[model samples]
Target: MINIWAIGMVIALIVTTIIVSIMGKRATANTADFYLAGRKVGFFTNASAICGDYFSAASFLGVAAAVYASGLDGAWFAAGFGAAFVPVVLFMASPIRRFGEYTIPDFLFARYGQSHRARIIGVVMVQLISIFYLAPQMVGAGTTWNVLVGQGLFGLSPYATGVWVVVLIMTLYVALGGMKGTTWNQLIQFWVLFTAMILVVIMGIVNGVGYSDSVAKNSEKPLLNPGKVTVAKLMEGEPGKRLYDVNQKNMTPEAFAKVQAVVDKGDPTAEVNILVPQKNKLHPERAMMFNEPGHRYSALDQFSMVLALVLGTAGLPHVMNRYYTNPSGKSARFTTVWVLGFVALFYMMSQYVGAIARQIIPPEVAKDPELMKLTVDGLLLKADQVMPVMGKIFAGEFGLGYVAAGAFAAMFSTIGGLLMASAASWGHDIYENYVNPHAEEWKRVLVGKIAVVGMATLSLLVGLGIPAAGLDKAYPALIAMMVTWAFSVSASAFVPTLLASIWWKKTTEKGALAGMFSGGFGAIFFIVMNILKETKAVAPDSFFATLGTLTFPVLITVPLSFAVIFIVSITDKKLPANVEQIWMRIHGTAAERRERRMQQMVLQPEQK
Candidate 1:
């Protein structure tokens, strides 16, 4: 059970952390340095770091698991993730950097004419998104640890140990190095993930599992459809008990007639009546193709997911915070270009990895009939376990360690960024602005470090309860499903408000507040309803079901938020008189701002 290679990987990670800590210590002399890295990061470095921060366990493992389980639908998840950067580069990057603020809340306060209401709302949304986002990373950490170590320390479960280890490591890194250290660590983690994926793909090819052949083999069989329901009779003593013939709902008229004929001639004393698939012929003649839709989503769900991902990237605090580290607007724009390139390549490789995993690992039930009890439907016992299983299949024990190390790297980089973002919001936005307005620079840094520890501890406790909550089994790919909720909330709450603030001068403080509350609470409400329905606490045919069926809430919440803001802003007669000045500062070029500052300096001397 002991993995020597895994121990080596952990040692390597520790050594890298020490080196980055040393470098970060040199720069952590003040609040500005700790939070923004002195605003001196260049384009390529910042892009790489952003990739690390953005590609969480959701991207690294969940994408592969999704493809393995859902085929083309899973691939679309990766496509949406890669395509999200388009909107970020086209609309948000340069303008956000030009605003020149440390955090999103700072921008909100300034844009709304220094409104405390705007700042408080910004803090609430940021914390909500960050905390929700952090949970998946911790889940990923626990999953990887369960696979890699397969043992618990003392009385702790493997899952709990994994959560604690990752939380502790990330807390130390963020607390010591701040933004500068986290960025450097992220840069290194991204390459490690990229390289491991490439190696897996190469090994698969060398082992004679060509991409075309794997796709062909997988496409030959019918994809599993969870939505098609069938009816069966219950026994006398067993109330509400039913048996499911997964293929019965999808059968053609001819197939159904043949099945009915057999059922009609069979034993009449059977307790349950259902038509099952022929034991010898598991593959259906009419099956789903890899290029077709409806494998995992309806037309509405597909559009909703794509919309959330595309708009959500623009609103994520951890990703947007990286832009604030850039020296100028131009650097932020260039960094976005690099991020798109790197992320596209990563996603392309991940889809292929999923295909390869499916080809190499035969379902456990096929190998041992007894294992079916532990499996969902005799395919993958656990979808998240596919990556590590494939690693062991293609490269033995050492390969499992290498791939698991990459998985841990993915979690660490993402969690570090999330913790740093939370710290900035709590320490700078809330504590500094509200608690002690006259606090020194060193005191602010200490507060930020403390915030990082507090947030990490909270995330760890939440992660420890995830398995018991049955989240791991409810969704096909647990990390991706949870992450989609985070994205939906972020896109609905932040994207519309931020866009209006930048482009529409009529956006009043009251309008912004209404939009934020409507968008944030609306998404949360629907998400809770969905959970309730899933747990059977609410009836599927009830009113809550209508709101909960749609996995991505952005389709409803985003437009609703926009409408409220627009209506409220137009109705309110009060407007900030210096709106034009704030607009110029946000939209103006660097040269124009420099000239205005020089004029102010000269006029100040004359007035004195």
Candidate 2:
């Protein structure tokens, strides 16, 4: 255990406390200020904050862990995550701001006219994504607390004490800081995160060369390509039966659930299991991580992550929400460019460290204390710990402490953004806009704080269920898996509307409403079907895998949404008639530049 590391973490917590206090003093009573930083943040500040908000524990720890386990396939996740932002920069940022809306609901209501069903469905989807997303952050904080504290400090279980303490601090921080406080915290945390990753990556590469040299001298086969192994489907515990075949058909949740009950009741005839291989060259225990083909290959190469990162960024709720913090639409765009540079620099370092960990950490350690022998278990050790473990290995005690500090910083920064987003949706959008339109600035701020705390509490409860789901075994993969849900929902719902609202002339209120419902409910159905298959009733992999793995399968949802809006708008016979002029502003950089020139023209006389 690294005692000094634990002490450093305590110091970081104290620093957070102080920063929250300062932010509270500076925060205004206005709900807008609380939710959107009073619409006056600078480009650099907003950029850093956006990076902080965007890079959750998933990015910090999850990506590196993926690369460590799955080799090149894991790199796609990091690339995809980063690339998702590009669409935001090119298409969504300025136009969404030009619409001048506070939340997604507000944007929809304003664009389509008041529609209760649309707002309700959109809100529910936001809540689902926020809550589900929050769990992993809590899990991450808990994992970091447990791993670092257990090694460095004296007492307390990691699961109980770590999660509680981390949540409490995060809740307080967001409650007091609001958007302004969160922005500052995220900015500072981004630097720390970037620094830690760079240091670790450099150290990792240096160590990698040394390890490779040693392995080259000792090994019979090349380190990159070991030995082959074969596999065939066979039922476990019952020798004669073959596993339930997924390749033959698509099974839904209801059928899967029935199959599960039958199996539980001791079916007279049943077959279950997929016979995957382990590497013949490695220890028998080491072979468990491979798929049926004796290698780890992710099926998610359909969209180049770089393209997703570039396009998906425009549509992400939390990231897009930060645009409201900027004083104007142009500042938001500038901030995005900054985020790209910062994130790119930081991820390079983390990826290097992941490569290093693959070489250094003994595959045996993954299974030293578990039923799952070393490899599968090794590949998935609480994804949150991948970076920290690398920190511990590379720099020893100091590295561990640095990693712990970085982890907590990353957790709080992300939680601050999520809590603020959740608060904005509930407090500013719903409570003030609908429930009490006449509420005072101070009252609105107070309500937002309350909502923030309440949401954090709810998320904490869900966080407890995460470990119970037996997901703790492979925490990183779970975190990455959960991210797909957020992506699916956001990409399905927000992307189409954002594009139509910005570009299309024929888009009408009815079209917007239809698009919203299609995107929102469609995502929900897919997710529910996937979750329902957990009982092993239907084919375990069919519906759920299809729902999750094809995040960008626009063929199913996008066209349906686009068509609904098109047909409905034409039937309604009411389009924004000045849509061409409006699109000139929405799609072109000319208007923004012209606005800049006009501002300069006015300021010239004042300066003289």
Number of the top candidate by lDDT? 1
lDDT of each: 0.79, 0.63
* Model 1 lowest lDDT segment of ten: 274-283
Clashes of each: 0, 24
lDDT of 2: 0.63
lDDT: worst 10-residue window of model 2: 221-230
Residue 438, candidate 2: alpha-carbon lDDT? 93
Q: Mind giving the per-residue lDDT tens digits that candidate 2 earns over 329-447?
A: 78878987888788776666555555556456544353334212222213333434678776766777788778777777777777778888888888877888689989888888888
Off by over 4 Å in 1: 225-291, 363-378, 598-608
lDDT of 1 by residue, 185-301 (tens): 999988887777777888888888776677788777556522212222311224432223343454345434544554565543433223222211112343556545555565677
- The TM-score of candidate 1 is 0.87
Residue 184's C-alpha lDDT in candidate 1?
93
